[model samples]
Target: MKNLCYTLLLLSSISSFAQNDSILNFQDETIYRINILLPGLEIEKDVYKDFSVVGNLGLFPGYYKNNNLFSNSEEGFFFIPFIDLQVRYYTNFNRRIEKGKTIVKNTGNFVALKFTNYFGTATDHRSTESVRIAGMAYDIQRTYWDHWHLNFESGLMANFRC
Candidate 1:
Protein backbone atom coordinates (compact mmCIF):
# COMPACT_ATOMS: atom_id res chain seq x y z
CA MET A 1 0.00 0.00 0.00
CA LYS A 2 2.83 2.46 0.77
CA ASN A 3 4.51 1.78 -2.62
CA LEU A 4 1.26 2.38 -4.46
CA CYS A 5 0.74 5.76 -2.72
CA TYR A 6 4.34 6.82 -3.49
CA THR A 7 3.99 5.85 -7.16
CA LEU A 8 0.80 7.94 -7.51
CA LEU A 9 2.53 11.01 -5.96
CA LEU A 10 5.51 10.74 -8.36
CA LEU A 11 3.24 10.46 -11.41
CA SER A 12 1.27 13.59 -10.38
CA SER A 13 4.51 15.58 -9.88
CA ILE A 14 5.85 14.55 -13.28
CA SER A 15 2.58 15.50 -15.01
CA SER A 16 2.62 18.99 -13.42
CA PHE A 17 6.27 19.51 -14.51
CA ALA A 18 5.44 18.44 -18.06
CA GLN A 19 2.54 20.92 -18.31
CA ASN A 20 4.77 23.80 -17.07
CA ASP A 21 7.56 22.85 -19.51
CA SER A 22 5.17 22.92 -22.47
CA ILE A 23 3.99 26.42 -21.51
CA LEU A 24 7.58 27.68 -21.15
CA ASN A 25 8.62 26.31 -24.56
CA PHE A 26 5.72 28.03 -26.38
CA GLN A 27 6.98 30.58 -28.93
CA ASP A 28 5.29 33.96 -29.34
CA GLU A 29 4.64 35.18 -32.91
CA THR A 30 4.94 38.73 -34.23
CA ILE A 31 2.27 40.41 -36.38
CA TYR A 32 3.22 42.24 -39.61
CA ARG A 33 1.42 45.49 -40.52
CA ILE A 34 1.26 47.39 -43.86
CA ASN A 35 -0.13 50.94 -44.26
CA ILE A 36 -0.97 52.27 -47.75
CA LEU A 37 -2.85 55.41 -46.72
CA LEU A 38 -1.53 58.94 -47.14
CA PRO A 39 -2.86 62.29 -45.93
CA GLY A 40 -1.31 65.79 -45.73
CA LEU A 41 -2.06 69.46 -44.87
CA GLU A 42 -0.17 72.73 -45.36
CA ILE A 43 -0.85 76.37 -44.28
CA GLU A 44 0.90 79.50 -45.53
CA LYS A 45 0.60 83.13 -44.52
CA ASP A 46 0.29 85.58 -47.41
CA VAL A 47 -0.68 88.74 -45.49
CA TYR A 48 -0.12 89.10 -41.73
CA LYS A 49 0.12 92.83 -41.21
CA ASP A 50 -1.61 94.35 -38.19
CA PHE A 51 -5.15 95.46 -39.00
CA SER A 52 -7.40 97.45 -36.70
CA VAL A 53 -10.56 95.87 -35.25
CA VAL A 54 -13.12 98.32 -33.86
CA GLY A 55 -14.32 95.77 -31.29
CA ASN A 56 -12.64 92.58 -30.07
CA LEU A 57 -11.33 91.14 -33.33
CA GLY A 58 -8.55 88.92 -34.71
CA LEU A 59 -7.31 88.91 -38.30
CA PHE A 60 -5.32 86.23 -40.14
CA PRO A 61 -4.32 86.10 -43.81
CA GLY A 62 -2.05 83.50 -45.38
CA TYR A 63 -1.54 80.73 -47.90
CA TYR A 64 -3.04 77.26 -47.47
CA LYS A 65 -1.48 74.01 -48.64
CA ASN A 66 -3.40 70.74 -48.81
CA ASN A 67 -1.53 67.63 -49.88
CA ASN A 68 -4.04 65.10 -48.61
CA LEU A 69 -3.74 63.24 -51.95
CA PHE A 70 -1.31 60.46 -52.77
CA SER A 71 0.18 60.06 -56.26
CA ASN A 72 1.38 56.67 -57.50
CA SER A 73 4.67 56.64 -59.39
CA GLU A 74 5.22 54.68 -62.61
CA GLU A 75 7.51 52.31 -60.74
CA GLY A 76 4.68 51.29 -58.34
CA PHE A 77 6.03 53.74 -55.79
CA PHE A 78 3.51 55.88 -53.90
CA PHE A 79 4.29 59.57 -53.42
CA ILE A 80 2.51 62.64 -52.07
CA PRO A 81 2.61 65.92 -53.99
CA PHE A 82 1.78 69.16 -52.12
CA ILE A 83 -0.64 71.75 -53.51
CA ASP A 84 -0.11 75.45 -52.75
CA LEU A 85 -2.64 78.27 -52.38
CA GLN A 86 -3.34 81.79 -51.15
CA VAL A 87 -5.90 82.09 -48.33
CA ARG A 88 -7.29 85.22 -46.74
CA TYR A 89 -9.52 85.84 -43.73
CA TYR A 90 -11.24 88.90 -42.22
CA THR A 91 -13.27 88.87 -39.05
CA ASN A 92 -14.68 90.84 -36.09
CA PHE A 93 -15.81 89.61 -32.70
CA ASN A 94 -17.48 90.99 -29.58
CA ARG A 95 -15.35 88.92 -27.18
CA ARG A 96 -13.39 85.70 -26.79
CA ILE A 97 -15.74 82.70 -26.78
CA GLU A 98 -15.31 80.52 -23.74
CA LYS A 99 -14.94 76.85 -24.58
CA GLY A 100 -16.25 73.97 -22.42
CA LYS A 101 -17.81 74.24 -18.97
CA THR A 102 -16.10 76.48 -16.45
CA ILE A 103 -14.54 75.03 -13.30
CA VAL A 104 -16.29 77.48 -11.00
CA LYS A 105 -19.84 77.21 -12.31
CA ASN A 106 -22.05 76.76 -15.40
CA THR A 107 -21.69 80.32 -16.68
CA GLY A 108 -19.97 80.27 -20.10
CA ASN A 109 -20.84 81.58 -23.59
CA PHE A 110 -19.25 82.16 -27.03
CA VAL A 111 -19.97 83.92 -30.39
CA ALA A 112 -17.88 84.16 -33.54
CA LEU A 113 -18.13 85.20 -37.23
CA LYS A 114 -15.47 84.68 -39.87
CA PHE A 115 -15.07 84.91 -43.65
CA THR A 116 -12.57 82.79 -45.60
CA ASN A 117 -11.36 82.62 -49.20
CA TYR A 118 -9.19 80.11 -51.01
CA PHE A 119 -7.31 80.49 -54.31
CA GLY A 120 -5.10 77.91 -56.03
CA THR A 121 -4.85 74.66 -57.97
CA ALA A 122 -3.98 71.33 -56.41
CA THR A 123 -2.92 69.48 -59.55
CA ASP A 124 0.64 69.70 -60.91
CA HIS A 125 -0.52 69.92 -64.49
CA ARG A 126 -2.95 72.76 -63.63
CA SER A 127 -5.80 70.62 -64.89
CA THR A 128 -8.12 72.02 -62.23
CA GLU A 129 -8.48 75.35 -60.43
CA SER A 130 -10.85 76.49 -57.67
CA VAL A 131 -11.82 79.64 -55.80
CA ARG A 132 -13.97 79.55 -52.73
CA ILE A 133 -15.69 82.09 -50.48
CA ALA A 134 -17.14 80.99 -47.20
CA GLY A 135 -18.39 82.47 -43.96
CA MET A 136 -19.37 81.12 -40.53
CA ALA A 137 -21.39 82.70 -37.74
CA TYR A 138 -22.04 80.92 -34.46
CA ASP A 139 -23.50 81.80 -31.08
CA ILE A 140 -23.91 79.64 -28.01
CA GLN A 141 -25.68 80.27 -24.70
CA ARG A 142 -24.90 77.99 -21.78
CA THR A 143 -25.72 77.62 -18.12
CA TYR A 144 -23.45 78.82 -15.33
CA TRP A 145 -21.76 75.39 -15.09
CA ASP A 146 -21.81 74.87 -18.88
CA HIS A 147 -23.08 71.25 -18.88
CA TRP A 148 -26.00 72.22 -21.17
CA HIS A 149 -26.17 74.87 -23.90
CA LEU A 150 -28.17 76.43 -26.77
CA ASN A 151 -26.63 77.31 -30.11
CA PHE A 152 -27.55 79.49 -33.15
CA GLU A 153 -25.49 79.58 -36.36
CA SER A 154 -25.74 80.67 -40.04
CA GLY A 155 -23.35 81.47 -42.86
CA LEU A 156 -22.78 81.91 -46.63
CA MET A 157 -20.81 79.36 -48.72
CA ALA A 158 -19.67 79.51 -52.35
CA ASN A 159 -17.23 77.83 -54.75
CA PHE A 160 -16.15 79.09 -58.19
CA ARG A 161 -13.74 77.59 -60.73
CA CYS A 162 -12.50 78.13 -64.29
Candidate 2:
Protein backbone atom coordinates (compact mmCIF):
# COMPACT_ATOMS: atom_id res chain seq x y z
CA MET A 1 0.00 0.00 0.00
CA LYS A 2 2.78 2.47 0.88
CA ASN A 3 4.67 1.80 -2.37
CA LEU A 4 1.51 2.33 -4.41
CA CYS A 5 0.81 5.68 -2.76
CA TYR A 6 4.38 6.86 -3.33
CA THR A 7 4.29 5.89 -7.02
CA LEU A 8 1.00 7.67 -7.62
CA LEU A 9 2.24 10.86 -5.95
CA LEU A 10 5.39 10.88 -8.05
CA LEU A 11 3.44 10.44 -11.27
CA SER A 12 1.05 13.25 -10.40
CA SER A 13 3.90 15.60 -9.63
CA ILE A 14 5.57 14.84 -12.95
CA SER A 15 2.35 15.54 -14.85
CA SER A 16 1.90 18.84 -13.06
CA PHE A 17 5.44 19.86 -13.96
CA ALA A 18 4.79 19.12 -17.62
CA GLN A 19 1.62 21.19 -17.57
CA ASN A 20 3.45 24.16 -16.12
CA ASP A 21 6.13 23.97 -18.80
CA SER A 22 3.56 23.95 -21.56
CA ILE A 23 1.90 27.04 -20.18
CA LEU A 24 5.11 29.00 -20.52
CA ASN A 25 5.06 29.12 -24.27
CA PHE A 26 5.47 32.30 -26.21
CA GLN A 27 2.74 34.81 -25.32
CA ASP A 28 2.80 38.36 -26.65
CA GLU A 29 1.77 41.35 -24.57
CA THR A 30 0.49 44.84 -25.34
CA ILE A 31 0.55 47.45 -22.62
CA TYR A 32 -0.89 50.94 -22.51
CA ARG A 33 1.06 53.70 -20.87
CA ILE A 34 0.03 54.13 -17.24
CA ASN A 35 3.10 55.30 -15.41
CA ILE A 36 2.91 58.63 -17.16
CA LEU A 37 -0.39 60.34 -17.88
CA LEU A 38 0.43 60.29 -21.56
CA PRO A 39 -1.16 58.67 -24.57
CA GLY A 40 1.07 55.77 -25.52
CA LEU A 41 1.17 52.10 -26.46
CA GLU A 42 3.76 49.41 -26.00
CA ILE A 43 3.97 45.99 -27.62
CA GLU A 44 6.20 43.07 -26.73
CA LYS A 45 6.57 39.90 -28.75
CA ASP A 46 8.72 36.91 -28.10
CA VAL A 47 10.83 35.85 -31.07
CA TYR A 48 12.31 32.85 -29.25
CA LYS A 49 12.27 31.26 -25.80
CA ASP A 50 14.62 33.89 -24.41
CA PHE A 51 14.51 36.82 -26.79
CA SER A 52 11.92 39.48 -27.50
CA VAL A 53 11.38 42.78 -29.27
CA VAL A 54 9.45 45.74 -27.92
CA GLY A 55 8.10 48.91 -29.47
CA ASN A 56 6.50 51.99 -27.99
CA LEU A 57 4.76 55.05 -29.38
CA GLY A 58 3.66 58.15 -27.53
CA LEU A 59 2.19 61.58 -28.13
CA PHE A 60 2.01 64.71 -26.03
CA PRO A 61 -0.48 67.41 -26.79
CA GLY A 62 -0.12 71.11 -26.34
CA TYR A 63 -0.42 73.11 -23.11
CA TYR A 64 -0.35 76.77 -22.23
CA LYS A 65 1.08 78.65 -19.24
CA ASN A 66 1.06 82.25 -18.04
CA ASN A 67 3.29 84.31 -15.71
CA ASN A 68 6.55 83.15 -17.21
CA LEU A 69 9.80 83.94 -15.41
CA PHE A 70 11.97 84.17 -18.51
CA SER A 71 9.51 86.32 -20.46
CA ASN A 72 7.12 89.09 -19.38
CA SER A 73 4.01 87.04 -20.13
CA GLU A 74 4.28 83.74 -22.01
CA GLU A 75 1.47 81.62 -23.37
CA GLY A 76 2.23 78.83 -25.78
CA PHE A 77 1.20 75.46 -27.11
CA PHE A 78 3.45 72.53 -28.03
CA PHE A 79 2.98 69.03 -29.40
CA ILE A 80 5.44 66.16 -29.47
CA PRO A 81 5.44 62.64 -30.83
CA PHE A 82 8.00 59.95 -30.20
CA ILE A 83 8.75 56.31 -30.98
CA ASP A 84 11.07 53.70 -29.47
CA LEU A 85 12.28 50.28 -30.61
CA GLN A 86 14.11 47.84 -28.43
CA VAL A 87 15.51 44.30 -28.54
CA ARG A 88 15.83 42.41 -25.27
CA TYR A 89 17.34 39.13 -24.10
CA TYR A 90 16.10 37.66 -20.84
CA THR A 91 18.90 36.22 -18.69
CA ASN A 92 16.87 34.16 -16.21
CA PHE A 93 15.50 31.87 -18.89
CA ASN A 94 18.58 29.67 -18.75
CA ARG A 95 19.56 29.94 -15.10
CA ARG A 96 16.33 29.20 -13.24
CA ILE A 97 14.12 26.17 -13.17
CA GLU A 98 11.62 24.76 -10.73
CA LYS A 99 10.48 21.13 -10.37
CA GLY A 100 12.11 20.40 -13.73
CA LYS A 101 10.02 23.12 -15.31
CA THR A 102 11.44 26.17 -17.06
CA ILE A 103 9.35 29.29 -16.70
CA VAL A 104 9.34 32.10 -19.22
CA LYS A 105 9.27 35.44 -17.50
CA ASN A 106 9.66 39.10 -18.43
CA THR A 107 11.09 39.96 -15.05
CA GLY A 108 14.84 39.70 -15.22
CA ASN A 109 18.02 41.52 -16.12
CA PHE A 110 18.18 42.31 -19.82
CA VAL A 111 20.46 44.03 -22.25
CA ALA A 112 18.75 46.07 -24.92
CA LEU A 113 19.59 48.05 -28.02
CA LYS A 114 17.24 50.92 -28.62
CA PHE A 115 16.47 53.58 -31.17
CA THR A 116 14.35 56.64 -30.52
CA ASN A 117 13.03 59.53 -32.54
CA TYR A 118 11.25 62.69 -31.48
CA PHE A 119 9.69 65.69 -33.18
CA GLY A 120 7.81 68.65 -31.75
CA THR A 121 6.69 72.21 -32.40
CA ALA A 122 6.07 75.05 -30.01
CA THR A 123 4.14 78.27 -30.62
CA ASP A 124 4.31 81.11 -28.12
CA HIS A 125 1.04 82.62 -29.39
CA ARG A 126 3.42 84.58 -31.65
CA SER A 127 6.32 82.86 -33.47
CA THR A 128 6.65 79.11 -34.06
CA GLU A 129 9.63 76.96 -33.12
CA SER A 130 10.24 73.36 -34.09
CA VAL A 131 12.78 70.66 -33.22
CA ARG A 132 13.73 67.10 -34.06
CA ILE A 133 16.00 64.59 -32.40
CA ALA A 134 17.22 61.03 -33.01
CA GLY A 135 19.23 58.75 -30.81
CA MET A 136 20.51 55.19 -30.35
CA ALA A 137 21.37 53.75 -26.97
CA TYR A 138 22.51 50.59 -25.22
CA ASP A 139 20.34 49.91 -22.17
CA ILE A 140 20.16 47.61 -19.18
CA GLN A 141 16.91 46.86 -17.40
CA ARG A 142 16.39 44.96 -14.18
CA THR A 143 13.17 43.78 -12.61
CA TYR A 144 12.98 42.80 -8.96
CA TRP A 145 10.25 41.06 -6.92
CA ASP A 146 8.19 40.78 -10.08
CA HIS A 147 7.00 44.37 -9.64
CA TRP A 148 9.78 46.91 -9.27
CA HIS A 149 11.79 47.70 -12.38
CA LEU A 150 14.69 49.99 -13.18
CA ASN A 151 16.54 50.90 -16.31
CA PHE A 152 19.85 52.59 -17.20
CA GLU A 153 21.06 53.65 -20.61
CA SER A 154 23.89 55.48 -22.34
CA GLY A 155 24.50 56.46 -25.95
CA LEU A 156 25.16 59.21 -28.43
CA MET A 157 22.36 61.53 -29.54
CA ALA A 158 21.87 64.44 -31.88
CA ASN A 159 19.38 67.25 -32.22
CA PHE A 160 18.32 69.15 -35.33
CA ARG A 161 15.90 71.82 -36.41
CA CYS A 162 12.70 70.65 -37.92
Candidate whose TM-score is highest? 2
TM-score of each: 0.23, 0.52
> Tens digit of lDDT per residue, candidate 1, span 8-54?
99999998754233222212322121212323332222133211111
lDDT of 2 by residue, 1-162 (tens): 999999999999998766555434445543233225555666667787667888878876666757867888776666577777877776654444433433433544566666666654444364334445455555555444544444576776667654
**Model 1, position 85: C-alpha lDDT score:** 27
* True lDDT of residue 154, candidate 1: 52
Q: What is the lDDT of candidate 1?
A: 0.32
What is candidate 1's CA lDDT for residue 56? 13
